[model samples]
Structures are given as structure tokens and as C-alpha cells.
Target: MSRVAVLMGGRSLERQVSLKSGARAEDALERLGHEVLPIDAGPDLVERLSTLAPDVAFIALHGRDGEDGTVQELLDVLGIPYTGSRVSACISCADKVLAKHVLRDRGIPTPDWHAFSETAFRELGAAQALPAIEERLAFPLVVKPAGQGSALGIKFARTAADVPMALVSAFSYDRKVLLERYVPGRDLAVSVLEDADGEPRALPIVEAVPNEEDFYDFEARYEIGRTRFVCPAELDDELTGRASELAVAAYRALGCEGFARIDLMLHADGGELDVLEANVVPGLTETSLLPQAAEAAGISFDALIARVLELALNRA
Candidate 1:
């Protein structure tokens, strides 16, 4: 067994979730008979990694610096192998604006959206373009931070009047904000994992049904029992195939490797599915969609962790 450093609990808003994921991963690593070193990633990350010098880094960190290529670059400099996407892939997955552009450019179906940086709105009078944007995308827009995951800085704007406060909520989490057309329907997620032959395969689809809220926000995601999850998503043969295909396409288009979870929305009216965002380091908590999908696909939690670590080691 090799020495593994599980990085988690950064200063992001998703810190708690990352900690949970790290803890679970640690348990699995221990059970697999590997030495596990849990690191609460902070300013002393370099110092700690240098002193410890683990064989591999199993990143359980989420949001901001964790998923935005900051730590990946550091790992590269330290000559350490890390799990998940590379620097460019992390950059693409961490920013919602970039992810959507990549999906659209690859001929993948994503929701119609617009991106605005703080400079554009605060300095260049981008607010003047709001009316035109609303006219194009229509009402009930999904305003979200361009760089946040786990639905942290997402808000709904039912009308033109709601856009400002929604923008405020989104900009608070990130400098850039993504304004997307809301598809009022079922919540779906598909996790992609690499096969033994190094092929990316989409796991069974998982559907999240929020018990109380109209949207699956932060609380609905981590606070268990707030939502009900259905593995295989009850989709028909054709729908399942399409969802899986889109997921694999998104994964490859974003240059993701090892593993990733693709979140999507299935529209009720048109029955169309649109890509929301890709999570590079998905949560491993009890309620996280990836673990649930893995279980449905007959891969146990410990086995999943082992597979992820194996992929990283093999790549190195």
C-alpha cells in the first residue's frame, strides 16, 4: 500500500462538504490498507506536503482554489501526482462560463446563458444590457456564480425586478456571474468513471427530487432527507442512452479524466435535457450523487475510492 494524502477543507463556502468527503475517503483508504494523511488545505499546504511527501494526493477539496487549478498547479510544481483533471481541465470545470462555452462549442446541448464580470457591470455599465438579456432568455432565469459548485450561490429570478438581487447574490460568491434560462423540471446527475481499459463510461443516472424547495440548493444537497434520490432515474431506454451519451461528451469536451459528475436538468414540457455544470471533485458524503450512482452501478464506496486512487497512480 502507498502513502496517500487526502486534501480537503479549504476556505471555500463548501468547506464542510469537502471535510465530509475527505473523512469518508480516509475511512475507505484505511480499509483498503493504505496509509492515509488527511490535510486541511490552507496556507501551509506546500510546507506540509514537502515535509510529508506522500506518494499521491487524493483531492477531496471543492470550490475556488481547490477546483480552479490553484492546487493542481502547486501539485505539479511539487512533482506530486494528484487525482482528477489537470490544470486546464480544472480551470474549465471550475468556471461555469467557460464550461458552458466549451459545451456549446463542442456541439453539446447546454442551456442558453449570458456571463457578466464585475468589471463589466460595475465599470462598463453592463446593467444597461439587462433588459435586452431578459428579453432574449425570458423570465425565471437561473442566476448563479460562475465559479461556485454544490449550488452555493444560485438564485432564481422570476422577473426583471428579481435580477438585481439575484445578481448580487451570485456576484458575492464570484467575480463573474452566469445568467441561465431556468428549465422547470426534474433534476438529474450522471457520473462518469474510467474503465480498466482507460475508457470513460457513464454510470447509471441519478435523479434528485427536492422535498420542499423548487430548486435543489445547498441545503437540499448536503442536508440529507431534504431530497430523495432515485438511481437509474427511472428514465426509459432511449432517454437513458441520451443522458449517458451527453454526460460522456461533456466529460471528454471538458478534458476531464479519472472521474466527474455531470449535472443536468430534464425539462417537463419539451422533454429536453440541458447540461448545467460539471463537478471535477464531486462530494463523497452520504448524500452525494456520485457515491449513490456508483453503488447503483455495483461499485462499493471503498472500491470507488480505490479505483480513483489507482487511476491517479497509473497516470503518474
Candidate 2:
């Protein structure tokens, strides 16, 4: 068995959640007969990693520097193989605008979006940007930081009146923000993992049914019972298969390897489905979407963790 170091708990807004995912991953890795060490990533991350130097690094981090290629860059410089996408892929996926552009260029179905910076919004009256955005993306748009995870700095706006507030909230997280056309319908996520044959394997689709609000937000994601997870998404076999294919396509289009989660919307108007965004290091907690998908695939939590470790080791 390989000695593995699972890194989590970074200087990001999702530190607590990362801590929880790391703890669970540690337990799972140990159960799989592997030697494991759990490290809380911080400003001293490089120093701490140098001291532990394991066979591979299992990154269970989410949000900010954790998912935005910072950790991957350090691992690359150290010549250590870690789980998830490479530095370039991680950075590309971390930026919502860039990912959207890549997906759109590939003829993949993604919501229309416009990138706006604070300087542009404040100095240049939103009229130019607003009209352009209005022409492409309609009302009821989604405002989100171009680089964030775990639902932080995400807002659903119904009218232009909500633009200022949404912009401020999203800009608070990152300098770049995306205004995307909101695709109304069921919220679903598809997890993709590369099989031993080096081919992408799409897991079962997971439907997110909000218990209280109209959309699944941060509260619904972390708070217990705030959302219902229906495995296999209760959709027709055709739609399920199509969604699964679309998800894997998005993953490959973004050049992500190991594992990733693709969020989608099954449009309410019976139109074509739309891709929301992709998560490179999807949450590994007990309640996260990837774990839930694995459960539906008959892979126990321990087995899922083992699979992730196996992929990391083989890639190394």
C-alpha cells in the first residue's frame, strides 16, 4: 500500500467543509489498508508538505487557492503527484468565464454569460454591459464569482434592480464575475472518473431537490435536510443517458482528469439542457454529491476512497 497524505483545510471560505472532507478521506484511506496522514493546509503548506512527503497527495480542498491551481502548482513544483486535474486544467476550471468559453467553443450546452469587472461596472455605466448582457442573457440571471466553489458568492437575480447587489456580493469574492442566463428546472450533478482503462466513466446522476428555497444555495448544501438527494435523478433513461454523456464531454473538454462533478439544469421550458459549471475537487464529505453518486453505483465509501487513491498512485 502506498503512503498517502490527504491535504485539506486551506485559507478559504470552505475551510470547515474541507476539514470535514479530509477527516472522512483519512478514515476511508486507512480502512483501505493504506498509510495516511491528514494535513491542514495553510500559509505553511509547503513547509508542512516537505516534512511529510508521502507517495501521493489526496487533495480534499475546495474553494479559492485550494481549487484555483495554487495547490496544484505547489505540488507540480515539488514533483509530487496528487489527485484531480493538473495546474492548467484546475485554473481553467476554477475560472467560470474561461470554462464557459471553452465549453461553448466545443459546442457544448452552457448558459449564456458575460464577464464584468468592478472597474468596468463602476466607471462604465452598466448600460453598455447591461444591454449587451440583456441581449444575450435574459432576465433572471445568475451572478457568481468567476473563481469560487461551495455556492459562495452566487446570486439569482430576477431583474436589473438586483444587479448592483449581486455584483457587489460576487465581486467581494473575486475580481471577475459572471452574469449567466438562469436555466430553470431540476438541479442535477453528474460525476465523472477515469476508469483503469484510461476512459471516462460517468457515475449516476444526482438530483438536488431544495427543501425550503427555490434554488439550492449554501444553506441547502451544508445544512442537514435542507436538500433531498435522489440518486439516478428519476429521469427518463434517454435524458439520463444524454446528461451523463454531456457531463463526460464537459469534463474532457475542460481537460480534467481523475474525477470531476458537472452541474446542470434540465430547463423548465422543455428546451435543451444547460451546463452550469464544473467542480474539479468535488466535496468528498459523506453528504457531497460525488459520494452520493458512488453510493448509487454500489461503491462503498471506503471503496470510493480507495479508487481515488489508486488513480492518484497510478497517475504518479
Candidate 3:
């Protein structure tokens, strides 16, 4: 058994969620016979890690400093092995605009998007740009911070009047904002784990259907019953396989390692499946997609944690 540090709760909007993830991961690791240390990553994370050195860091962080490669870089500098994507991949995947550019270049199907700053939108307003944007991407585009997760500062603009407010709100979370064609479809997510053999294994696909809301928002995602998840989602076998393949492809294309979750939009019209985003550090809570998928794959929570640690240790 290795000495593992479960790191979580950074100075990010997802701090509370991260703490929960860390707690779950910590418990799972302990049950698996690993000597584990749980640490709340705050502003002085570097100082804290310097003192409590561990063989590997099981990063349970989400958003901002935790998910954006900052913590990964710190671990790299400390010569400590951590699970998930490398520093560069973390930055590329965390930034939606950058990830889309890479995906588009690779001929991956994704919604057409445009990135703009708040000042540009404020000065130009909607009449000049909105008309053309509406024509190209159309109305009902998605507005979201270029680098964020858990649906923070995300808006669906269905009308011209909503564009300005959406831009303002999205920019508040991140200076760069993404405006993309909103694909009307069933929301689905797939988690992929890279085993010790360096092979990527896609887990069962999960279909997320928000009950009241049109899309999964912060409240809908965390609040029980707000969204219904169908694991091994009821899909045609071919569709399910395709989604799983696309998920693994996306994970590799973004340079993610160990494990990652890819979010997708399967259009209702069956036109095409669009990739939304990839989460290198997916939630580890009992109800999170990654854990649920693992459970479906015959891996218990403790076994999953042990596998992740084994992968991290090998990297060390």
C-alpha cells in the first residue's frame, strides 16, 4: 500500500463539491488498505504539500486553480505523481475555446462556436454582430465562461434581448466567453479509464435528463431528482458504441490520462452527436458519473480508488 494524499477544496467555486469528492475518495482509499492523508487545498497549498509529502496525490479538485493545471504544475514541480491529465492537457481541456479549436482541427463533431471578450461585445452590441452570429450559429446559442465547469455562468440565449445579459454573466466568471450553437438533444456523459496496460476503457454511457430545466444547471445537477440519470443509457447498441468511442477519442485527443469524463449532446433529430467538454477531474462522489460508471463495470468504489492510486504510483 502506498501513502496517498487526497487533495481537494481549492479556492474555486466548486470547493464544496471538491471537499465532498475528497471525503469520498479518502474513505474509499482507506477501505482499500492504502495509507491516506486528506488535505484541503487552499491558497497555501504549496506550503502544505511541502510538509506532508506522499507517494502520490489523488487530485479530487474541480475548477479554477484545482482543475486548470495549476495544481498539476505544482505537483510536477514537487516531483510527485498525481492522477489525471498532465499540466498542459489540463489547461487545454479546461479552456472550452481551446478544446473546441483542437477538436475542430481533428474533424471531431462539435457545435460551431465563437469566442469574444466582454468589452468587444459591449462596444459592438448585438445589432452589428448578433445578426450575423445568429445567421451563422443561429439564435438559441449557448453562452458560457470559456474556462469553468458545473454549469457556472452558463446561459442559453434564445432571443436577441438575452444576448447582452448572457455575455455579461458569462464574462463575470471568465474574461473569455464562448457563444456556440445550442444543439437540441439528449445530454449524455461517458467516463473513460486508462488501465495499467495503457489502454483506454470506456465505461457505460449515462444519459442526463433534467426534469424541469431545459438543460442541466448548477442546482439541477446537484439537487436530487432535479435530473434523472439512466446508466447504460437506453440507446441503440450502435449509438452507444459510437458515443463510447467518441468519448475515448476525445479523452486521448485532449491528452487526458488515467481517467476523464466527456460530455456530449446527442441531438433529438439524430442529426449528429456534438462534444460539449471534457472533465479531467470528474466528480468522485457516489452519485457522480465516473463512480457510477465504474460500479456498472464491476469495480467497487474502493477497488476504483485502488486502481486510480495504482495508476498514479506507476507514473511516479
TM-score list, all predictions: 0.96, 0.95, 0.95
Worst 10 residues of 1 by lDDT: 214-223
Alpha-carbon RMSD, candidate 3: 1.8
Please report, in order, the local distance difference test score of every candidate based on alpha carbons.
0.91, 0.85, 0.86
Give the residue spans of candidate 3 off by over 4 A: 122-127, 213-222
Model 3 scores a C-alpha lDDT of 0.86
Give the per-residue lDDT of model 1 (tens digit) for 210-276: 7777463544554667778889899899999999999999999999999999999899887888999
lDDT (tens digit, per residue) of candidate 2 on 236-279: 88899899999999999999988899999998787468888889
Q: Roughly what TM-score does model 1 have, to 2 decimal places?
A: 0.96
Say which candidate scores most in TM-score: 1
**lDDT at position 121, candidate 3:** 61
1 against 2, candidate with superior TM-score: 1
